[model samples]
Target: MNHTDHLLIFEPEMAGHQPLYIRLLYHYLLENKPTLKVTFVVHPDINKRLVKEDGIKLQTVGNKINLVFLNETEISASLHNTLWIRAVNRWRLMKKYLKTTGANHGHFLYFDHIQFPLALRLPFLPEKKISGLLFQPPMLDFYGDEKNLKEVIRNYRKKWFYTLMLNNTALSFVYTLNPLFPSYARKHFTNGNKAYHLPDPSMFPTGDINLSDEDCALTKHVGENRKLFLLFGALTKRKGIFEVMEALKHLEPEYISQIAVVFAGKLEAGIRSTFLDKVDFYKQNNPNANLHVEDRFLSTNEIISLLQYCDIVLAPYHRYFVGSSGVLLWAVGAKKPVLTSNYGLLGYQVQKYHLGISIDTTKPKLIADAFRRYLNNPDDYERNTSGMERLHAESLPENFARIFFSKFL
Candidate 1:
């Protein structure tokens, strides 16, 4: 239980990109950091799902990779379950784990949930060498000359939080997925030098990915000549599903005929009926629209298969979306182009890397116009080879691991 040459990775949630992030880090440690003893602390449900059902082969990797299942709710006790309560409870779990294992360093895979509590209570906590990966830093969302009262208050509050969190002597480093935020942080905050840019990993399954019958069937609908525009991952209204459908209405039949739109991944239960109804209505109106829906959870391999099959990746996120996206990285990894929102960090990256077109996704006409331009000459919008190479180099899973362990190693 007492190991000085050890690092503990604490993660609770398993949905969305959590599992992929953990797998990438875990496998990286096992392969590259052979001498480092690492312990992964996750929820009991994740233990049952990832270890037992998914067969990640952590057990086969010998004792170097320690799997510890700690139920997060146990730490919460009988406290009224607010966000602060939950954040504090998670922090308590991490502190206890660090104390129990005598780990030299601690890292949080997803720390945005617990950051405020940790910042406020770090003085009380005994841990000295702890770091966390921040996916969404509100400071990055602040555009110049804020006029809204509520927005100004929120921005100032975030600034205060960042000031406390970064200036704390206990924190070794705060890793960020926003590659551009580190410079801004260093210039603005007192101890912002600790802000390190951890590349958002874009790597996906390549070579011969085992495709299912359903996967094969999904690709068959794209036919021979038409370009496929794919909107992958969890389907929610915020993903601009309605905007896409409305945009399709603006395009001419000939334009719609040349392109196919596929809504892949599980539709949010709240909007499933509405989404299906829209799809049906679109089909009824434009018979040659060529729209397909794989309304369920897609495996990593299946997603990669789809990525390889598709022509353009649609990432028309809502205006409020400020964080980096896994979809953008997947598009880059696949050497494909994306039509994303020109609002926040996503817009900055697409424009910086020349990944594809960035526009105001709120307007259906803009989305339609982007499609028309791409359809006119797909080669004109294709991501450059150098751009893809640079993005890939920066976003490799190995870089994510290296930067994460920079303080410890």
Candidate 2:
């Protein structure tokens, strides 16, 4: 096991989330195993908006890790073949390095959020030996609306190409993004090992933002009369915000008035106006439905403050919600109970840690019933949070690295 020669290959430009995991793992390697080489082939998307200390920044972390921000678009134009821009750059970048260093053998570790798409061109990359960390396989059906022949052909290509990569690739280790991923991936990678679960460490506080005043203010908004239900993260269609609204409406006006629904995160395109419009409608008739909506990206402290002050954390993701959730981990760390989808990893964690309710978010009746039941007896779920104490200990960065390395078998 020549750990020094290993390459950590990933595109740290998908969102604020992708780069965060890389930074966390970089620190882990920096402190414990300084010999390992870490290379970040970030896309320009990162350079534009997400440069906050919380986002991925190209600062000097360690001598071993190389931060290579190549012109990914350059490779796209260069390749006449139908290969995607990311894969083309990944191949070109590695080929350039291999040519320069004259190194024959090195392990490639792929831990990208979009793992399956990389398979579209992995065979073209130079590395002979490869491994991957799949928190969740890309749900192809949920990818887009156009299920035409072109999309179907692309889907078949992904499967065929991925099968080739898996047979040649040394190991394909699966992790629970949600409970569905392990089984979901195993159906494809029969030889792959289900890895020990690893939590996202960025969920831990940076200790930079003091949320004492913020938490006090938020709690004061809820007052002595209301239970706060919080939906945190970048608002998206898959997050089931509309379904949650439907469920809330199913409750009697009295129950609705007693609860405060706070949507705290950057709203997706076109969702802000609709969300606010619905919120206004709800507020006009049911003044008791104390709605506190923050239509912007949440800072780290804001996330912490939401978890600290809220009575319940809302997940309610769709079938597209495979693998683990960074948002859920924050709520768990705060020891706040959650009301999430019972389908996959959310259900597992909710059961494992006694976090809170996990019901089918798509079924309005079920969502409403869960909300009603939870509202009727909040302490029943609150009492279950004692299980999370062990999870906090288990998910430390050092512990994650130890477990990650132990998956070598």
Candidate 3:
């Protein structure tokens, strides 16, 4: 009967920010809307991680909350590895589950994955209300000054894709993490289905800063006198870790000795050995280099503790990563300075908010120069404190959940 009273949330991803994002919505629904029944369809990995990793007691949340794990066979690639194909397959699975569960409303917790198919105008079930959160939308203009032919063509294609997705009658709302997206959506793509900007939530650390044994070892390796520069969360070449390393070579021995670098997250699969080898070679060649690596999954508390323990947060992502960054928010929440990329939304926020140094991170020399500036006199950049509090306030989880859910639900 009253299908609108029930909400079905489908999230096939468990890595990165997926678990936290789903938990935020679940808790918000539980506490804010007591009568709303929820059914969470997630990857089997979520079952293993929900309670143990995130400390969420599903049984205690309420009787109205239900957990359903996705069938791997249903959403699996089955040989096709393309993103749109996988997105379409996931869409099919969600539609099937929506019908089976008899819920008229569904929400995609990680909507970016489904966007490819939606952009291509895939068949969405008629009359079913759907909402999704978008993290990396290509429609946003990331390259303003340095636009080549390929970049221009890509932006136009993605803008067209946004138009197609926004015009879908079944889609109720599209929420983006970038604050600039809503105005862009209004000016460019006019549709009854609203596209709104949602603040990327920041979970500030609480209680005592207790470092894990591995983290303690990292702290010991870096020592106490040197300024710690942290590159956190899913360490990969794309995150500009190697560029930061190469930038080290340009610094003098005294500068290197005064600063320490830590890569404190699981390295992307297959790149661990190569990264470690480079670290080893750099250490061997420059004994003054204080580089430490923790190539493993870090706990949430450990990550926050590391954030508090460090002097500066490093988010030197390449220009290709134009979306908002959780690391940037965490650094702001922790009131630490950052050396980030001057490319897209992330760069704009850093520059606008005086969060830290935003440079062209693709160049090692630029990164080194930023490091030098920070090393020279960190207090000189205390002017970066102006907008940190405002950004942190806007990024609270309650604000994120409220704005997103209030849109259509």
Candidate 4:
């Protein structure tokens, strides 16, 4: 690893769970390959989740990585909603960054975000070697107001459409974070050795999580005789949080007092108010409902601590959610099992990894039945911890970085 190879991870626009994985991978590459000169081009605006130091410590080493923040690569109030404009601005910034770094003919570039309409198709940039991690393929998306008939047609067209889309890109390799991506989606990439399935390692909980499980207020609800089941992360209808809460109400009274359910994460104002009303109803009828809510986004330390506190993570996701669940993986990282959806990528990953129980989350009775099952024998799900360490080893940020650069470059 010399001047002959340079790895550039272009991540100027942070969105979704990118911040969580970016932080994990950044620290991994930093610790594992200290001498490797990697350039990290980040967004000018600082996000604490992406770059925060616990206490007053500075996370950046300032030597291995050349942090180039573009001042003009941003969208303001008037035209901020337009994706095309912002993407183009970031695109312009990327070209400028390559020039500024004096990147040579065969340097490696990884774009954390997938570009659109005018996508980040690097075939045009032949001088530099390229690799990208696709967080969402077109097949993972469903259009607005699409009817059931049209949706069926779209699902059929999407695999072919995605295959063609990636086939045309001149990238040396394109990796999908989801290993369960429809096999037919890429006839060549899967079979021709062009596309790789990089199991997403985005769920690494922040530092020393197991050390402070007793320090968090959330865990206090999990008494010696009680088991804790958590519905963590942002609250939304798509995540099946409402249905989960409703299911909690239907839990048998004996089970209700024995199991504590927590919904923790930032809730939109309307959702928060409605959630409180529902909780109030439960409280008025019987405190045995035992539901607690921590309605705010969690910090890195808090997230890890919360996961450690949780006995079982609930990811009863909507079947329509095509991608994987960060919450489910976070639980896996904490060596906990999940109660999740039985359809789509989330379920596939859960089953593939043997991480938890898959349930038809759309039905409240099914959810309640699943909860009863988990309570009957939590150890059944806990047995899946054997593969997690190996999964993390392969998915370590530096390992992913090494696999692409060492093999391709």
Taken over the whole model, the C-alpha lDDT of each candidate is: 0.77, 0.60, 0.77, 0.61
lDDT string, candidate 2, 57-113, tens digits:
654465666666647564344332443554455555555654554333322333442
TM-score of each: 0.84, 0.75, 0.90, 0.74
RMSD of each: 3.9, 6.1, 2.8, 5.4
> Candidate 3: TM-score?
0.90
Q: Which model is ahead, 2 or 4, in terms of lDDT?
A: 4
Candidate 3, 1-409: lDDT as tens digits: 1246667888776557767777787788777866667788877766466575556744424556778877668536411367677778777877887888877788887776666777667777786878888887765456334766876787787777777787777677878897777777777787723777888999775346655675455566667689999998878777998898889989988899898898988797667888898899999999888898988766666777677778999999987777889989889988998888888887788878888878889899999988888889886454356599888888998887777666544
Q: How does candidate 1 score on lDDT?
A: 0.77
Q: Candidate 1 has what TM-score?
A: 0.84
Clashing pairs in 1: none
Model 1, position 3: C-alpha lDDT score: 33
Models ranked on lDDT: 3, 1, 4, 2
Mark the regions of model 4 whose C-alpha exceeds 4 Å error after superposition: 1-7, 12-16, 32-37, 44-47, 50-64, 70-115, 118-130, 138-151, 180-193, 202-214, 268-286, 297-301, 376-382, 385-398, 404-408
Tens digit of per-residue lDDT, candidate 1, span 47-139: 344453235644425767888876546633413247777777767777788888777777788777656865695443554477888887767
Off by over 4 Å in 1: 1-4, 44-55, 60-62, 70-85, 122-124, 140-153, 205-215, 269-274, 284-286, 379-382
Clash count for each candidate, listed in order shown:
0, 7, 0, 0
Candidate 2: regions farther than 4 A off: 1-8, 14-16, 43-58, 70-122, 127-129, 138-164, 170-190, 193-199, 205-224, 270-272, 380-382, 401-409
